[model samples]
Target: MRFLSLIWSNLKRKKLRTSLTILSIVVAFVLFGLLCSLKEAFTAGVNMAGADRLIVRHKISLIMDLPFTYGSRIERIPGVAAAVHWTWFNGIYQNEPKNFFGSFPVEPEPFLSMHPEYVVAEDQKQKWLQTRTGAVVGRTLAQRFEWEIGDRVPLTSPIWPRENEEAWEFDIVGIYDGAKKSTDTSGFFFRYDYFDEARARGEGQVGWYVVRVEDADRVAEVAQKIDDEFANSPYETKTEPEGAFAQGFVQQIGDIATMLVAILSAVFFTILLVAGNTMAQAVRERTEELGVLKAMGFTDGLVLVLVLAESCLIASVGGLIGLGLAWLATAGGSPAPSILPVFYFPVPDMLIGVAIVVALGVVTGIFPALQAMRLQIAVALRRHA
Candidate 1:
């Protein structure tokens, strides 16, 4: 503790160099914090996928439609509890791509039954069931568009355009929220009956089916059975656990986790070299002072600790500041709301960032610290500049 002042003095001797080193550390950790949050945002759906849920889709492609009757057949399969179907609406709101979000046509009762995580009022559920043209938007979507109950929201679909050639208007009868932070609150769901009847083509067709299994452990078995039932048919099916289905979307963009980790690793490695050089230079300049301290009875271990403490102090100060800024940015809101709807600095990730700070300090300081520890007082004094 008494040597802290000496360590502080050594760092202060080269203010600009030390400041630059700290600033570099700040940048590295800021990237670390934001990258962690970004990874979380991209993988939120896969992480929060329902344990007992499985998805049944066309074997060839997701865009291919399956027989709507498959829903009932899937529900009846052994180990399957229930099933609901949703077809992609491919909707644009008010002729703008910025207002784009995932909209789907679905059976209200079965959809609600399958998704216990979507919380809505009982009256809202009833209103959705009764109103044929009614639609339910997620809370995030509602807030984005400032939609309210009974608001008529018109969404235009290029693929499934209405037979009348007008915009497919729907009354927003309900707004649903997620039970957990990771739950998806960006999807807009509407009645499948209206969709089936109004569209020009693909009647009695479904884009995909979400199945709930009776036992979570039996999800794989149920998924296989569901696929086997439709084999050798005109519309072949592929069934997989819901988590894997969500993961497929992420994989399409490439492995975000691995990419982010690789980028972070490269950035840290460069920063390590930069910081290590700065420490070496600073120690080299202070040879005479370190020799004086040793002559005054400073032990080798104390010299090592002082050098390491100086390195750690730089990392700690910069790391805390960088992480604090990252947290504040995430708290304010997502920078790109349309793309990153679920952005936030997770506590566990922040803790990991903290750990990285400590590791960075130790790893960068060790060599310089050892050099200082092994320096003979007479030799160090001779080299003093």
Candidate 2:
């Protein structure tokens, strides 16, 4: 505490250089924060997914179709409460390539009733159930495009294109909101019956089944039973928890978790070099001042501690600022609907950031502090003279 003034004054001696070094650290940690957040977003489905919900898809892959009649059999399973099926509709709007969002054709009553976590008005529910061409959109999705109830939404899907390749138009009968953060609130869902009848081909095939289990603890048994029932069939079933199902899609891309770690390793390594250089330079320039401090009765250990403290202080301040900025950038309500999920800067990552700051400080300070400590009082003064 007593040496704080001296340390701070020394730091400010070359204000611009210190500021730039701090800024570099801030940038490095900011990247660290953002990268860790990105990794979290990628795996959020597995971490935050509901424990009771199980998904049944084709054994081969999600791209393959399952028999539509399989839903009734899955619902009849002992531990299964209900099963709802959905088909992907990769749709584009207004011939714009960038206008992309999730569109699904699902059994209205079964789908809505199975997932009560999605809140929709009774009147809107009734309206959606009644109208064949009705669509229910998520509140986030509706708000993004400024859509209102009763407005027409036209979407064109290459997978289920019309005979003339015209867009499929539907009325917005309801707007739904997720009760929990895990529930995706940016989706477009409409009746599978309407989609089946209107599509050019492949009417009896369903994409995947979302099964709600009566007991959360029996999810594994239920999944096993579901898979066993369809074994040896033309389209064998593979049942997994909701989280694993979502994770499967990400895994198909590549080992993103490993890739992120490698990237961060490189980033931190570069920061170490930059920070070390800054500290070494600071120590070199302050040789005369340090000699004066020794003459003024400062112990060798104290002088070493002072140099280390200055490096740690600079890194700590910059690292904290970087982490703060990263938190702000990734905090919910950013415009990255396509890539990022609803995510906050994770606490473990922040803790890791703090750890990095301290480690970097030590790494950058060790050599310089050692050099300062080993300087002979007479030789240092003679050199300064």
Candidate 3:
């Protein structure tokens, strides 16, 4: 208790410097929090993808299409549970390109059956499947466009243009909420028949196919089997686990995770230098007081411990404040870019924040503690006079 009082007194002796140091820590940690959240958002789909699902795209590039007939062959493969195909419509709602969202032509019945994670009413699904020009929208997309269950929405397509260059129209049959939190809630699905019938060419092609395997452990083997089946075909195939496919998309944006780690390392090193200098100066100024205590029978180790404790306390308090502010900021939610729709605070990250604080405390105190321990009582007393 007495040791704590001594550390507190020393810190209170220089209020402005302590406050400024704390503020610097706050700003740095806030940046750290933001960076980590952005990285997690970009990688969330990979981390949360279903274990038993696999994605099959074109061997050369995702932009290329595959034969729609391959869908049935994949479904018949051993250990394959279900399969569905979808092709990107690449449409715009208006002239503005910034208002981009996913628009895809899908096999409605098979798609809903394979992806049970998309929550839609049974009656609504039946209605969507029965109607030729009916559409099902994601919850997020419905809110953005103010679309209702019976509204007829007209969408402009860049990839699939109509014969008269007019906008395509569809009835909104339902709005689906994602069954899982990680499922993307910002796209709409329409009938493949509606798109196929209107197309002038490329009538029997799909952008990609998603397959569910009975055993997740055999995912790699099943993926190889799917690819091998089409090795000699005109449209080649490449199959991977759903998680790996999501990760490939993130890799296309460059190595953001590695860049974030480097930035954090640089920031922490700067914090260490600032904190170490502050503690060294504080101990130097207290040389005469420490000498008096030593002459009055205080042990050398106790003086060293007192100085170290002070440095640790300053770091810990500042770190806690900074971490708390970061938590609050993320919890409240911010307007994230379309690429990072699932941004949220994670529990493991908070624990890591605490660990960083303790590390900073120890690193900044070591040199000052050693300097105080090595001070000679006789020389310190002479300097005091």
Q: Pick the candidate with the highest TM-score.
A: 1
Tens-digit lDDT track for model 3 on 310-350? Answer: 88788888888887777777774435434556666566776
- Is candidate 2 or 3 superior in TM-score? 3
Writing each residue's lDDT as its tens digit, candidate 1 over 1-385 gives 7778888888899899999999998998888889988998999989889899998999999999999899888878899888889888888899897777888998888888888888988999999999999999888888788888999988888789899889998999999988987777878899989999999888999899998888998888888899999999999999999999999999999999899989999999998999889889988888888899899999999899999998899889988899998898788656766688788889999999899889888988999999999999999888874
After superposing candidate 2 on the true structure, give the runs of residues whose Cα lies further than 4 Å from its correct spot.
1-3, 108-132, 162-166, 177-183, 215-218, 297-305, 331-336, 339-344, 370-379
Candidate RMSDs in Å, in order, are 2.0, 3.3, 3.0
When 1 and 2 are scored with lDDT, the better candidate is: 1
Candidate 2 or 1, higher TM-score: 1
Badly placed stretches (over 4 Å) of model 1 are none
lDDT of 2 by residue, 330-367 (tens): 76553676455345578888898888889989989989
Error of 1 at 78 (Å): 0.9
The lDDT per prediction is 0.89, 0.86, 0.83
Extract clashing residue pairs from model 2.
none
lDDT of 3 at 99: 65
TM-score for each model: 0.93, 0.84, 0.87
